[model samples]
Target: MARTGTRSTIGRTPPELWPSGGTLVSTDLLDDGSVDAIAVPLVPAVEGEHGAQPGEGAADVSALYGIDLAEIADRVGLTGASGESYVLQLPRAVGSAVQLPWQALPPRVVLLGLGARSAADLRHAGAALARASRGLGRVLTTAGVQGSQSASQAAQAARAFAEGYLLAAYRPPTSATGPAPAPSAELVLLGRDGTRVTAALDAARTAAAATWLVRDLTTTPSSTKTPAWLADQAKRLAARRGLETQVLTPRELSAQGFGGILAVGAGSASTPRLVVVRYTPTNASGRHVVLVGKGITFDTGGISIKPRESMVTMKTDMAGAAVALATVLAAADSGLAHAVTAVLPLAENHFGASSYRPGDVLRVYGGTTVEVANTDAEGRLVLADALAWADATLEPDVLVDVATLTGAAAVGLGKQRGALFGTDDALVAALERAGEAVGEPLWRLPLVEDYADAVRSDVADLRHVPADAGLGAGAITAALFLREFVGSRRWAHLDIAGPARATSDRHEITEGATGFGARLLLQYLADLR
Candidate 1:
């Protein structure tokens, strides 16, 4: 329950659930006393060059003050290595010369390295500067503004920089240790012609705000985030963006025969819910995409419980649902022409007397029966019900589902990228391109038709888990099990077990749930035909 029309950041501060009221951005010229700090990019010296070279902002500084920044770089041993930074005191750097620009200047100037000037390198550079600017209120930066690149390339680079900055600024709400450092009040990106990259800047900010919301939702403790609670949040999300929301109660789910979802939630104190969010454009004339996410607020592995240490971070098991919810909201916020709908199956897999045992046969939507081999492999069960329901009822042209479904995904792909399994090559290529552009890379893992027999059950249509005594491809087997429900629809599956939560902060990822699929999915939908 939030008041309407607050006007903060992307679109209204969006209730207290989202801590970042979003940050205000501007493309105005530098004004003294208006900013806390300024970041100037320094291109490192090439093979035989003399010293570090100044980027757009540094060049402007040299022109305005009549000084040699290169000389200072040489004296200070500043090499423009990627992620390298040199701090310069504003008034002190100018020496005793006349400070002709204004009475007061920014307190500090950060000279950051732009190695190779590639998008990936610049994105890292932006994150580094943002992390360093922790205490500052307002900061101006030119980390990605290279004068030698084309207008389009410059705009792309600027977009990456702004996105990285906003993403790195996110800090989850905490109470154990006093107050956490607040995100910067405002961020200013310097454009070449004062307003040239304004649209790109705004788009980047909106997308980043969506990512922040996902992070907030995923990191919340399960003590507060239940299936019914997530349904309530759906209403809040629908209200913030002009969209439609619907919730299916336990009774409705039972009547509809969503056995997979109901079976997983039988052990938990809270009931299950299926939340649907839909977005239709003003002039709807594009391909329809249906998105499904696995929302397990807390996973205790049902009857087969996990180790105590393994359950510590289980609160973030709902990250995939967070990604889907945020991406659909972002599509509406950006006003994408394509019609998009998100189906989230919400439940908590707790261990209790009522939990489904290892040999129970549960029927999913569309009357597809599955044998429960191990209760821990519950993600695919819920996703199966949603995927079947969406394909049968939603009339979607394409289907995509995201989930933190398997530890084997992290074992195979490490912690950097997600595992992508899809039937359509063109759709897979589009998703890969979108992921590459957003720094959320995806590695394609085969659906391996030969391995399909491993999931077949002797007592049911399929077994949710593979044989424990023989085969090993857990991630692939899980995807193949989910594929059975798609029923010829062009679909893609994202197994984000590794990248969904970060073990340690790196790149633009925080220590909690990474909010992995939000940015990549939004980018894909934005560019969809």
Candidate 2:
């Protein structure tokens, strides 16, 4: 069929021509650069074993075939493909003694043990394989044991893993320094008969990669990716994916009475923008999903300016927008048979004479007036208008808003786990399940309706933040503020303050944008039906 075993993988270079760490590919063997066939041994390592040794049944086949072979006979397991020169898997993590030949198998293969098979681990493994594949300039593929008890779960894992790996490996043309290199391709899930794990993995991976395309555009620098710029990005994506994109500028927003967005963007040079992206498949069924995201390009805290120390990183305030766009893209890529809409209210919070005062009471899109208690608390204001719009426009079956809304959320959930607040138990459960499936951790928290009274204003419909409320509940109060705008829609809020940006790690990725919800949202949509 599709070239079974490691021997068939000798010279494929869909992603790269060579592997990283100075490994040579079989494609570079001729005097003037020609391809040739090379033989490598395939050995399986079982648990509690040291190296491969010729087994009893293998003696007859070996004698009949007369194949040159080497043995590491220890019980390290391999998921797929048996061939000459294949780098076999050892059940446990063990160091390699010799330089691995690139052409022996795919350019890169990650042997993820059974213990570390979570979606996040798979993502990390994918990232590792992508780096190796990109360096080698060859196509990268992964093979692993089908461990899940459920066939669908196993298939989902394989596909999700392939998608994450391929997307992580992508290097955009804009990010390239000199004469750009070719893009790398991805493959995964080998050898599971009647299993269609490959098909599922391919579909999921395609969807995940598409989400990354949108996320990358949103997570880029503020100088290059302003509100208008991001709207353009959404427009381009919608067009490419056969979706609908609507961009509203400052004038249109003001005409439509989106006072919250107008107020937040008044102080910045860049005008506020509201981008609504919609995806509707031909035979859409089931519940409609709505996503709202905060799009603050940079948060200077208005008149309540932030400290000069590390304020530069505030550009990532729009991380919520990135997640929103990525989620929509993921749905489209996964071919989810549902109606999805992503609404992003984009702005830059800064200090200027035209900025709204602390006592300003502005009417939102839904005629709800909010007193601006603290200008630093600006993300909720912008999101308030968009959330109102999402509810009024779609009246969706379920609405979920994602934001890097509060530092308190970061403190509450750390950099990896996100806090989920919602009125809908079913939607929350689905999101949590999707998070687990994709390795993006999400935890549920109480809305504590009592806190709603805390945000009530003496004059306006509500106060943007509760002055009486302690700083302990900043994240909760923020979610509560947006809750007022959600109306009767089944809604959830995800605060991803900590995980959106990163510091550093030992991985090939240094630290800038984490590219979070793209994969998670993709898988969520895929599993919806």
Candidate 3:
């Protein structure tokens, strides 16, 4: 239950299904006219006006159809309303004797609707167009997010379009490819030539690169994503990005008293590891932000095994770690002024002879004991160890832990949003703003101090989860359980269980790992003082 009602699977999957933002934003298309489509965004008509305003490059595209866009929209009964799309097919340019190379197959001219020109609407429009252009060689979009706007405004629109396009034009690397919305080799956003707009789009592409990496890592099959594999990926990232990294082995974990992590991973032969990555820029902001991501490689609910259906998507349990690692690397890529450290406690919860059982008490990092009430609640257990370790060692100004910790989050918020909880209001608001800007919206739920007693253990300092299945507010109690690890720090918890993975394609989200936190955290870090 991380980022959605459930989590997922990956590894051995070829990444050929989607482009990884590598040379995705181009100034021009192929010289041989590989572009199969041109998407021009449309703005709705004014209250009293007759037709909608056409996006840039519309005149050039409409000429190919021998009619203006307004007439085409009217002819097709296409209203430029939000989420509306119309593809005006050019069937061999209506039997033209002399056909241009681009008009050889009557290519496509798509009109995408932008509602109120909001960032999200713009992103959705881009996503819709991308989906419509699936399986094509190339697509050039005049996103209609430019002109008559300030530099920042123009940059915002460009960023949104790029993010949306890069994100939505993806399909899982699966063998059975039956109408899963194949991605184009390249998607060029036209009319983004200014310096400010170029840099903004560049940054957004960088962020998308990070998220793509996250999705790839989380999408791998569990057998290929063991704790060692996760640590190796982290090391590879550190080596490539010049970040400081350390991978702690199981022996070291036990010596350092990471009881929770050790216990949760005991049943798995892959062992457990804690990967610490540090990014210290030269002119740092002097404010440290320590991130702790739950790295459960595959969750089988330990002794409390899940139903056969529930186990299907459990491999995405490590999505939080993938996002945390990706975000830190993106921050380093952007050269942010702040110092960021990410602690990913990697494990796999399996049911075996050594599986930590209910009624078992184990000491987590920083020497706090927890009662294992529910083995399925291993996410918070692993996160607690990392949070405690970060608070005791990193001295971060702001502490944030990310996890797909509970299904209750999806139960309350659905699959559209993530659950945000924190001890500091300002931190929460900043995060809210960042999430909103990145199109990964968050819904803040109160800490509910009264729920503190629900996680209280009769035997240990805390219980991993309430013993009663009927106990409501599972998300709140789960957050409360995590609150005990950070000591008086300005901390925030991102329970991405509601939106970490998607059940189907929606907006810019595909039917797999959503990689929700990477962009949001990157945005927040960019705005930090």
Candidate 4:
């Protein structure tokens, strides 16, 4: 049985109560009782442009609310700047109730600036509006500023906005403070074309919910989400999605010669587990894609313990597994035509008398011997076994592994993007495009063939870490080590250490577990379809 209950519907709008597209009524046609807030876009003012005439949307909003728009702008110091927000209380004229046959307008009017009119900018604006409208019931967003954009462009912008809003509203409880209050805000988009806007909203909602699931799993305490617990969750998810699921026990792993995983997991009381989930369509195209994740529930660095501070968020070491699980679920939900398989190598690396140490040679699956240079580099060890197993058993056409494998990646890419290393140029480009489309950007790092020499071992076929401790390219070396298990197959290694978690809330990203690779992998799978 799964230890945790079903996830809270904290960031979701109930299907029956989900906001529907409202008519694009003039501001004068809106009723005060219909909504609690109205959000309008405000672009930055041009150098020579008169501040009196802010924009068409602002003018319409000012006239509808019967307020002096210029005076409000001046009072609020709104120079039509981006990322700037100001809320104005609308005056309720006595005995001026209009019997308009349109959606009612909220009492509060929000002025949001459009910094660059880019998708990222739209997402940020949407998140800010969501945050501001927390206690408010419903918000009506007018897309007048984006009306001139093409239908597809408009839909993209709407999707970004919805994503931002839904993601911002998420707040998972950390203590016995009971559950956080459920978000009551309903997002209704007003636009020239209601059908297209509705479609965009639905799509964005699905994608955002998938990301929320990833966040929930990754943020759960490691003690509550052990290797077996994660496998059980995978099994349940696979059953619900009509996907094939297989979980291998520690005894089974040893029988199959997954020495890398067994050795890394020996120190932990909870044995390791390998979960394989497959989504195969009946008329599937032969484009088989395999996703491998490093599911280290908690990393204590075994005998080679990390600094006390470094282990603070060690529970997030399994972010890669969470991404893979969410991606597979999303792919199955979308009913794509391509066959997909997700291999999750789940384990907890702790220090104990039974712990595997340096100088240990692990015979990974597919018979590759890896010398353990550092016990702390356990993510790649487990992943190596999974990658080799998937390659040998699944023989997938494309293989991609996502892992929080190195801090060097964070140092190289910062927290803004993930490090992507791949054998195939086309695969790398596809992943890059997919990541960019979803705002989970990936920067390509070279898999310099010469770096392979760094892992060449004297006692074994390879070393898990670089031979020289001072050598740079830790991220690149980790990827190169994983490449050995893939043989000549097309593969991509995503070092998601940087973007998987955030130090602070920014844009659409929350403070914990950013769900970084879920959307990117989903997009990639969609393209394959």
Scored against the true structure, residue 431 in model 3 reaches a CA lDDT of 98
The worst-scoring run of ten residues by lDDT in candidate 3 lies at 11-20
Q: List the residue pairs that clash in candidate 1.
A: none
Q: How close is candidate 2 to the true structure, as a TM-score?
A: 0.78
Summarize candidate 3's per-residue lDDT along 143-228 as a digit string, tens digits. Answer: 64455878678778877876777787666654233344355436666665667777887787778777777887878778777898
Segments of candidate 2 deviating more than 4 angstroms: 1-121, 139-142, 146-154, 171-195, 469-471, 505-510
lDDT scores of the candidates, listed in order: 0.81, 0.65, 0.81, 0.80
How many Å off is the CA of 416 in candidate 4?
Answer: 0.4
How are the candidates ranked when ordered by TM-score, highest leading? Answer: 4, 1, 3, 2
Those runs of model 3 whose alpha carbons end farther than 4 Å from true positions after fitting are 1-34, 49-53, 93-106, 174-182, 467-469
List model 4 lDDT by residue over 1-529, tens digit each: 2344444432233211133334434433255575777777777656687442354366666666666667777677776554567887755545657443222456788877666667777778777877777777777766334547887787777888777777777665443445565573777766534567667777677777778877888888876788998898888878987889999999899899999889989998889999999999788865888999999999999999999999999999999998888888777877777888999999999989999999988899988898988999999999999999998889899999999999999999999899999999999999999989888999999988888899899999999898788889999999988988997889999999999999998878889888899888988887763
Residue-pair clashes per candidate, as listed?
A: 0, 28, 17, 1
Instruction: Give TM per candidate.
Output: 0.90, 0.78, 0.89, 0.91
Error of 4 at 246 (Å): 1.1
Which 10 successive residues of model 2 have the least lDDT summed?
A: 2-11
TM-score winner, 3 or 4: 4
Put down candidate 2 lDDT per residue, 1-529, tens digits, no spaces: 1111111111112232122111122122212312221112122345775444332123422342233233222234333122112333313223665543332333222322222445555555455455444444333232333334376666655654565455555543343234554454433233232336656655655555544453455446677666887777778767877888989998899899999999999997878899999988778776688988888988888887888864777878888887788778667766678788999999888889899888899999989999999898999999999989888888798888988889898897888888899898887888898888766779888887877787889989999989785646888888888899988888999898887766763232326666666556666666776
Q: Distance (Å) between predicted and true CA of 93, model 4?
A: 8.4
